[model samples]
Target chain A: MWTSRRRTRAALVVAALSLTALTAACGGADTAKTAAGAAGGKGGGAVLKIKDPGNSGPLAVAKKEGILEKRLAEVGATVQWGGSYASFTATVDAVRSGSINVLEGAISPVLGYLVSGKDIKIFAFTDPVTDPAAPQTDGLVVKPDSPITSVKDLVGKQVAVNKGGRGEYLLLLALQEAGIPADQVKRVYLNPDQGASAFATGKVDAWWAIVRAYPEAVAKGARVVVHGRDLKDQDLNMQAARTELLTEHPEVVRVYLKVLQELTAEAQKNPEKFQNVFLDQGPTAVSGPRLTDEIARTRYAKVPRFATAADGAFVTDVAGIFQKYGVLPTAVNPNDVIFDLKPAA
Target chain B: MTLEKVPLGVPASVKDPVEASVTSVKGPPKGLTKDLANDSANDSANDSANDSAQGFAKEDAPEREVRGGAGATALEPPRYLGGRRRGPVASTAVRVLVPLLLLAAWWYGTASGAISSEILAGPGAVVGALGELVATGQLGDYLLASAQRAGLGVLVGGGLGLLLGVVAGLSALGEELVDPTMQMKRAVPFLALVPLFISWFGVEETFKVVLIAVAAASPMYAYTYLGVRGVDRKIVEAARGFGLTGTRLAFGVIIPTALPNILMALRICLSVSLTGLIAAEQIGATEGIGYLVTLAQQYYRTDYMVLCIVIYAVLGLLIDLAIRGVERVAMPWRGQVAAR
Candidate 1:
């Protein structure tokens, strides 16, 4: 009984000391989380909670190491991350529901949100890195020995594509180029994971794969019928933010992009460090060589910058393709969605 | 899997209510028993029922020796009065050997080209990944976070369920008021409520916790309701005849008689909480076993994916063992009866 009381006393003392130290640290000048509700600080500070993109990039490394959070703190801004989602649709929904304010995604879904009278915008965009040695970010994968070699050959074939997503977008682009009508092919609407299984089990003759799916299919010897890079200018990766947040506190977005730029450069120099962060920190089955190659393909593409008018044309061209295919009733004007925070460099 | 005849000297231990009770402890409630009769019968097609009914295993043309225990040592006129205990080492070894054999098969599959690294990681890769999580201290942190979420969820949900169950089981008004709403909730899939919950609670701990609570509430309510309702009507009448009335009769008779089912409800609720955790932690969770799954899935890391599964399986085993311990402590009569 005596020892138990003594232990409790000692624990209380330690906790008290720790609490004091923590308060002192947190109340320091650089702490951005210090909400100025009645404290009367400038609009430069606000918490920017964004969606996490899971465990395969420099951003993931930032999440694990508190790199982005630390950078935000320096700029008198705080950052919180929502859960990683498997679908960009979920992430967009989170933004729509005000669960999160910012998301890094393809321009397609964000366009839908904008078209639906949501006050969202594309603040930053990445022009696709189209090098010959670049890893494919998206692909219409077929069996190695399949007779189908190009998009034109997809006529009357059962092709798996994520409905109204990058997979469908890529297939639509390729099919348009080959002068084949979208109705000629059977579009099997399935998600990436389902698409992978379907493509492998002979359930579908071809699967338009994207992001993680493309590399996994390639690893399994799925021949590429059409690569994202092969589509020329259609594949523009982007980071979108709600215009409400942008108008209210631009600093949060600014600090976020600044940290991403640094991490993007860091990932380029040591792609393995960022890509395999999950392996070193926790358990993972990352194909190191494949991920490193993927990092090269995506690293330069993630360099944070304001989009030029020419980059907006890709959005217009994509809209035109979707409109021509009659998938979307009308095209989203690039001007309405692209909120250029800075002039073209 | 057929058992031998009683060899002329063996005790009718299989006929004991103690062994019978254990087999039927997880059985369907009284209302569903008629439909489940074929499934529970000795010659049933249900392998799950057969495996769990250890003492009642097919008593046909037999090759059975009292497994892991000394049998028929006193096989004369007076049989052994009490149940013999199994050899712990032997039983545990058999249990441990199953996964080891599976591991061996997995190793062989990977070592050959039969299973590609893309499809599945080797055992070595998974072990290395486990080591990495341990090294970074992520495994412990994630486990603690997940446990806290599940524990809080089960406590709140199970408490609410128990209250409603007892009320509905005892009175007609409660059945009308609470049962219908609970039944409606029970029918709705928790996945369908994700968007609404996020909108209501935001993508934070509140959302995660609420989602888990909602998932845990239904099964707990079902099990507890069945348990309380299964309390013998005759026992209540007997207590009333003795002038025991109201809360007095309930505390002294109905609840005590229904204790076994309540304990079973606890076990089921605990297991259901894990499922809720997986669904809840999919969105906005920073640290948890489920988040590990999200990361592993995102990175397409089969090693981490398998490791997360192992973590869950181990957690489930621990939960089951803990409940068994509780059952042993709470129902000491069980041991006494089984010993006969």
Candidate 2:
């Protein structure tokens, strides 16, 4: 009886091994489907790989209209998208590795990357705060009924901020202006998602809430007790590129910027109509009206201005800040790192 | 012709010596002629070393009697340690050496850009991360927490499983009672129970421990049940002839001989407990190797992730070694095997 059962078990093992082999044989069907989808377009041979670290509404719009794809294609280029939970770090890694030529993410990580001696330069501004739109996505948010009414009140309190991005820099600027030393505040470093959870439970005294989380916090009874406008002269968001990729692939860089200009123009005129593009492509699920309101709130049309030496200077200044804060090495030069914009240069 | 040799074989050792003596009597063969030609090639290395160290060695040749086994045996070396056996040693060495070598390769590959650093971590960064974790004392705390949870999981789950499995396997009525339930229980994946477990137990340390225990229970049940039921019938017949009957017959005759199977069940339970704790840690724990890995990944610290994984692998090996040690102690007749 035992001998018969052992034989049966041996046969079962063999059958299982064969079944696993058969499953592997059918695994490439998904990859083939992706290829078939790609064949629907024949507009360009040059593929322009563009990545957005954040869940930006504009990206969904571009994806919906296929305008970013079409515009790049017309210039003999194609575009691919990459998303990240820690968008700033993802963008920094992408640029450092030359995997992506352009980054449409926040500015802090770009500063951190430059400070870390990576050859990334802020080629254009994507989101910036101006006079009319005083309170953009960048702000210090606190839970309801918290005694932390002002940035000065934040001394010795735990504040959650996404490390190595604009959020960190904005908080630093807020602290600096408040005459609170950076070390005085315990910065609980967490991603936006984690920060949302931390802030909800009172685990964090305050959070540098951005975009969806900012509004989500507001809906959840958290108040934006402080704004980025309160911190004067800040560089909010940037469209950066690796210096090597920009210099070597000048035409590709120009084509990418030109596409951005078209995207900006479309966004400025019919902001609501283009809301679906970013809504579909971004990480977060945002309604069209909400996205339109979000974009309108940023007044991004003025921020993604033509790439200039002043943009380069601001990047250098941000790099200096990163070094001063000891997040980056002190000896690094910003000028050597920033990719000199061809038209601006 | 040589292949057709009739059964005239003598001792092979004597044949080889005689043949070698005959070959020497031939005053060197064609192979010797080749060696003669390459003598100069061999001589150069010997001559160069001699020339370099010619006057250096003899002066103070510290007449140090090589202290053999210098303070070596504080603990007596086992005649045949279970862990030092060929199978276990090879498993240990392969398990450890492969990961270490892979880590070294990963470090070298990424730093040298053989593999892009964006995708794979370099060794220096991983080591630097390990150093950071050590300095912060994060690694030790996570390991201890995970180990304690897994140990508790095995003890509680294994005890319950042993009781249920033995009772169910012993009687026809008991088998019928648990048969359908055991079948259904085995079908449920441990992770699916996490939500229900959390609701009942909350996301506290108890919840994590209970989840691991529950995950461990099914495998232990199957192993112990099968072991008890599958005990040789002849042993039971002998116990019956000796007037041992009822529960006494089952416990005395059945469990004693099925002791190997029970030990094996414990081993299975221990391994499954470890696996369950990892899943528990992954979802909602504040501390554990899995949670540490999640933290590292979130912060983009690939090195820390690698370090945590290495520590987990080491812990698993230690668990297996401990199980084998227990197995040896429980079954003293089966002496330890020699190392390969």
Q: How many residue pairs clash in each candidate?
A: 3, 10
Question: Highest TM-score, which number?
Answer: 1
Residue-level lDDT of model 1, residues A176-238, one tens digit each, is 778898899999988787777678777999998887788888988889887777775474778
> Candidate 1: what lDDT?
0.69
Q: Note the Cα lDDT for every prediction shown.
A: 0.69, 0.60
Q: True interface contacts reproduced by each model, as a fraction?
A: 0.31, 0.01
Candidate 1, pairs of clashing residues: A83-B284, B3-B62, B4-B62
Which ranges in model 2 have alpha carbons more than 4 Å from their true place?
Answer: A1-45, A52-56, A82-87, A91-99, A115-120, A133-135, A242-244, A278-292, A298-300, B1-340
lDDT for each residue of candidate 2 in B4-68, tens digit (9 for 90 to 100): 22111111222354443332223222232343334323322222222222211221122111222
* Candidate 2 residue pairs in backbone clash: A46-A77, A47-A78, A48-A78, A57-A278, A60-A277, A60-A278, A61-A277, A61-A278, A108-A165, B107-B123
Off by over 4 Å in 1: A1-44, A53-76, A262-274, A277-288, A308-312, A343-345, B1-117, B120-122, B238-252, B336-340
Worst 10 residues of 2 chain A by lDDT: A276-285
lDDT of 2 at A146: 88
For model 1, the docking class works out as incorrect
For model 2 chain B, the run of ten residues with the poorest summed lDDT: B56-65
Local accuracy of candidate 2 as per-residue lDDT tens digits, A1-345: 543343234333433444465345335534664575477335535455555422344665566567677776656666765323234453444455444556665555665566555566666665454556433565688877889899889989999987866667778878887788999999888887678767776788999986556765665567787777666645656677766656666676676777667666776666655443432421133455555556575344542654555566566666556667876666445456445565734
Best by lDDT: 1
